[model samples]
Structures are given as structure tokens and as C-alpha cells.
Target: MAEESRKIIHVDMDAFYASVEQLDNPELKGKPLAVGGGGARGVVAAASYEARKFGVHSAMSGQLARKKCPELIFVSPRFNRYREISHSIREIFFEYTDLVEPLSLDEAYLDVSQNKTGMPSATLLAREIRQRILKTTGLTASAGISVNKFLAKIASDVNKPNGQKTIPPEEVHDFLMQLEVRKFFGVGKVTAEKMYRLGIFTGADLHSKDEDFLTTHFGNSGAHYYKVVRGIHNSPVQPSRIPKSIGAERTFRENLSSEIFMLEKLEGIAEELEKRLGSKDRAGKTITLKIKYSDFQLQTRSHTGGHFVSKKAEILAIARELLYQQPLRESVRLLGISLSNLNTEQDSSAPAAEDVSVQLRFDF
Candidate 1:
């Protein structure tokens, strides 16, 4: 028998944190608002549509955001409340389809080709799901329906808040061919510039390049570019996607030049890492150390162990080696550590903890 055609829907909440705040507080409606920490080093976590008009966006520094929109009201994020609402929304999704893949607390992809309601139209199902989310959580969501994940995800962004878009399989090729190269999933600013120089500015241009040409120019990613331009993405909506890495990072108020001070800061970061690992009961074989210089140059060093390391001593041992092996080029402003190649399976034995109170007596 021939295989069944796929139906994927990507659901994204509209400015989730800001919308939740507006729903809970009547006065915040129709005003420009941002949910974030408000300080010298603070960053915006979410921005309302009204705020977005002035070029405010997430990950932008609060200082610059204020400069862009002086009236932007900043509110601290209520993570617990957001999580509660996200749980309610997920329950609604499961009512329609068990094949749900959560991208974050406020977004997910659902395979609704074979749904609980036995509905044959994925577009109608998307509308129903959006309406249910609004009715249940008092917050609106946007949706995109397509034959695969990539197109569906992009479609969700077409009609802003509280809207849905569906791309029939028959229209997929035309839709992609007319789309801009910069709009493709993995294409960023640098890649777009390279494409422009190579005279590949649109999806049609990307499609025109042969597999060998793309591969020779872009390495492995060229293959992905070649396939996606033709609407050939087949990656599934995985329901059990585990996190590949966990990390903690901090930006200092003052750049430090002393190796002694940097090591002290790294020790605090390692302790936090241990606590996080213990909470998740996860260990990883790879340890990475990241640093940002005062001039904004970034550098990283990593080492992979034979076995997983989650305990404080084990993490610090590898982290310390990575730090000392590289000499500082300038004053450092940011530092971070991460663990990857994780072991998420339940381990029968408990991780042993040890204290290593070594002072920074040596200098590079």
C-alpha cells in the first residue's frame, strides 16, 4: 500500500509572556509592554506587538529597547504562571492528537493527519485548536498547517496574532520558489550575504544550484539548503526530543583581567552546574568553557571524557584544565560552562560529591 500523506501543524502563542500579563491585568491591554529584567545588563524576554512596532524584540538589551521605545513598560517574567498556562494548552492539544512535539513552553508541532476527532482537514483542526486554546487559557494562538514541519513553522508566522495559514501540498513548490532566500529556515545574515554574492537571492536561485555546487560551496549544510528549497523536508515531528546540552552563563558588571578572580567566578558557575545536573539527574561526556573578551571577541574550549561527568569536582577538574590551557588575550566580560553528549537515562547509582577548595595561587 502507498504511504499516507503527512499533516503537520505548528502552533505559536502570540507574545506569550506579554499576552498573559495583559490578560491578567485589564489596564495593560493595547499598550506597549515587555517582560524582562529592567537594569543596566537586563534583556527583553518577550515583547508585545505594540512594542515590536518600535523595533523592540526578545534578546535585545533593555537599555537599547528603552532607547527604541521610551514608553515600553517592562515587567518581570512570571515563569510559574506561564508554565501553568502552557500545561493547560498542552492538554488541549492532546485532546486532538497524541503526536505532539513541544518546541518551548508556548509553541509546539502536532501531527494531526490521524486525529482523535477523525477530522480529515488539518486546516479546520488548526482553527479548532486555536479556538480551544483561547477559550481555555484566555490567550490567543496562531497556527500553520502544511505537509511537513519546516513549511508549517514558517506558515504560522504569516498571519500575526490569532490567525492561521495552510499550505496545500499542491501549492508548496510555488510558495517556496517565490520566498526570499533570507526567509529560509537555516539562512542567517552571513549566509544570506554569501548567497547574494553568489547571485542566489531567492528560493528559485537556491533551487537552481546543483547538489554538487551547493555541497562544494556550503559543505554539509549545502545539502540541507538544496533539499529545503525544493520543499523536500522530511524530518519528523519527534515527541520525545531530549535536550542535548545544559549550561549556565553570567556577564560581569566589570571586566576582569586577573586570572585569580576569573577562577573564583568559574567555581561559582561549577557549583550551579552541579545543582542543575542533580536536579535533572543527567551527566554528560563533553565539557565546554566559553569566554567573551572586553572587546566583544568570543572564544571557547572543550574536552570530551570517556565517561559522563556531573559531580562538582569532575566538572571543575575539566573546566579548570580548559581555562588554564588557553591564555587570556584581553580583559574578559562574560564566562560560561556547558555539558553536552548527555546521559539522560536513569542511573541506579547516586553521583558522589566532593569538595576541592584549591586557591588560584598560579598565574598564566
Candidate 2:
């Protein structure tokens, strides 16, 4: 028997944080605005459409953003307000289907193949969802409708800032063939450059390369590229997806070479990780340390303990070991710590409220 096709929709809010600020403050609308810290070492969390016109964007340094748009108004992010709005939006989604996978506070992938509305057309459903969001939240959202998550996500960005696009199953092949290699999902700058060097500038070029050839050139991910280029993604929209890891990272204004300075930075990173784990009431067995050198090279080191680790002291101790286990290779510009192999089961020996514990494991 032939397989049944799935209907997927990817919804993305337009400049969510900055737009929320503008919605609350009417005077801020139509002006260049950014939401983030305004300190010299601060980064822009979000930039309004107006700010983007002046080349301002999210994750840009406050100093550089100001230089780009001298009149850019910087407003601190109100995460609580955003969360409230997100909850309201999610309620709207549940009205359609329970199979909703949230990517962030403002974006989600919805499996609307079997929906409550009994709507036969995914495009119509996307339009209805976008309209409902605008009506209920006083915010606009863009949506993409397709047969799978990968195609739906790409379609959503076609006509952005309050628009919707749908790629029917029959049109998938031609649409993908014309797509630029860089626009495909998971094709970052490095991968795109590699493709360009290999004369794979478009999906058509990528499609011409056989599975074996791509695998030889790109490893396991090469097989993924081979499938996606031919419009053959089968990844599902899983609503119950739990994060495999939690992490915190920071980039310094100046690179540090001294071991003493690196340790001090690791302490702060560990504290941040502890706070994050505490908020989620989560503990993990493996701790991974990530470092980015001034030249942008990245390195990671991990140690898995026998017991779950969540406490500040435990996290700090593990992080300290990971940092000093190896000699400094170069000046470091970024530092990060992450916890994986999360403990989801309850423990009886540990405290009744916080039953988190750890077990020793191998280190590499």
C-alpha cells in the first residue's frame, strides 16, 4: 500500500521580541528599535524591521548596532510578557491539533494532518492560523505549509512578516530543484562554501550527486543532503520532544590567555548552568565544556560522572576539571558549559523534593 502524506505547518513570529515592545508602546512603532542590553559588552537580542533596514540585527554587539543606527532605541527584553503571549498562542494551536512542537517562544511546527477543524486544505489552515494570531495577540505571524517539516520551514520564510506559503506534494520536486543550495535547511556558511567549491550551487546540482559521492565528500550528513535535495525529508513533528542537553555560553569582549582568567570565567559559566538546571529541576550525568578560540576554532571536552549533577558546587568542580585538563592552545574568546544525559527518573535516596544524584562514568 502507498504511504499517506502528512500535512505540516511551520509558524514563525515576525521580530517577536521587538514587535512585542512596539505593540505595548504605540509610540515605538515605525522607529528603529532593538531589544537587549545596551552595555558595551551587551548583545542585541532582537532588532525591529526598522532597525534591520540600517543593517542592525539580533546577536550583534550593542556598540556596533549603535554605530549602524545612531538613533536605535534599545529596550530591555520582557521575557515574562513574551512567555504570557506564547502561552496564549499555544492555546490557539491546541484548538487545531495537539501535535505542536515548539521551537522557541515565538515559533512552532504543527502537524495538522488530523485536525479538529476538519479542514481539508493545509494552506487554508495556515491562513486561518495566521489570522487568528493577528486577531488574538495583536501580532502578525508567517506560516509555511508543506508535506514535511523541512519543506514547511523553508516555505514559511518565502513571504515573511505576516504571510503564508504552501508547497503541495506535486510541486515539491520543481520547487526544490530551483532552490539555492544555501537556502536548504542545515546548509550553513561552511557547508555552502564547500558545496560551491564542489560546483553544487543549486538543489539541481546537489541532486545530481549520488548518495555514495555525497557521503564520501560530507560523511553522514552527506546522505541527509542527498535526500533533502530531492524533496525526500521524513522527519516528524514530535510534540513530546525533550531537550537532550542544556547549556550556557558567553563571548568576551577581549580574549583571555591566562589560566587564572579562564578559570574565573568558567566559574561564572558554571553558576549560570546551575541556575538553568535549577529552574528546570533537571540534573545530568555528562558535563561538556566548549571553547572557541580568537581565530574561531572550536573545541569540546566532556566528562560523565556516575551521578546526576545540578548543584553549583558540583557543576563548578566538573567545569574546573574540564578547563584545566588540557593546556591552553590559543587565546580564548568564548566559553560554554553544557549538561547532557539528563536524569528524568525520580530517586528515592536523594531529597524528596529534589531527587537528583550522580553516578561516576568514564572521561575522555
Cα lDDT of model 1 by residue, 1-364, tens digit? 2233788899999999999999999899999999996677677999999999999999877888999999999999999999999999999999998999999999999998789998888888899999999889999999998877989999999997899998887778888988999999899988999999999998898999999999998898898898788776776788887788898888898888988898899999999999998898989999999998876678999999899899888888888899899689999988999999899743548753232111112110
Q: For candidate 1, what is the lDDT?
A: 0.88
- Give all candidates' CA lDDT scores: 0.88, 0.88
The runs of at least 3 residues in candidate 2 whose Cα sits more than 4 Å from the true structure, single-residue gaps closed, are 250-257, 271-286, 292-318, 325-334, 341-364
User: What's the TM-score of each model vs. the native?
Assistant: 0.87, 0.85
Please identify model 1 stretches exceeding 4 Å from their true place: 1-4, 253-257, 292-299, 324-333, 344-364
Q: What is the lDDT, from 0 to 100, of the residue 68 in candidate 1?
A: 94
Tens digits of per-residue lDDT for model 2, 1-364:
2254688899999999999999999999999999997776677999999999999999787888999999999999999999999999999999999999999999999999888999988888889999999999999999998887888999999998899888887778889889999999889999999999999999899999999999998998998898788776766788987788999998998889997898888889888999999998999999999998876678999999999989878887888898889897999989999999897643547753321111111110
Model 2: clashing residue pairs?
A: 305-359, 306-358, 306-359, 306-360, 307-358, 307-359, 308-357, 308-358
Candidate 1 clashing pairs? none
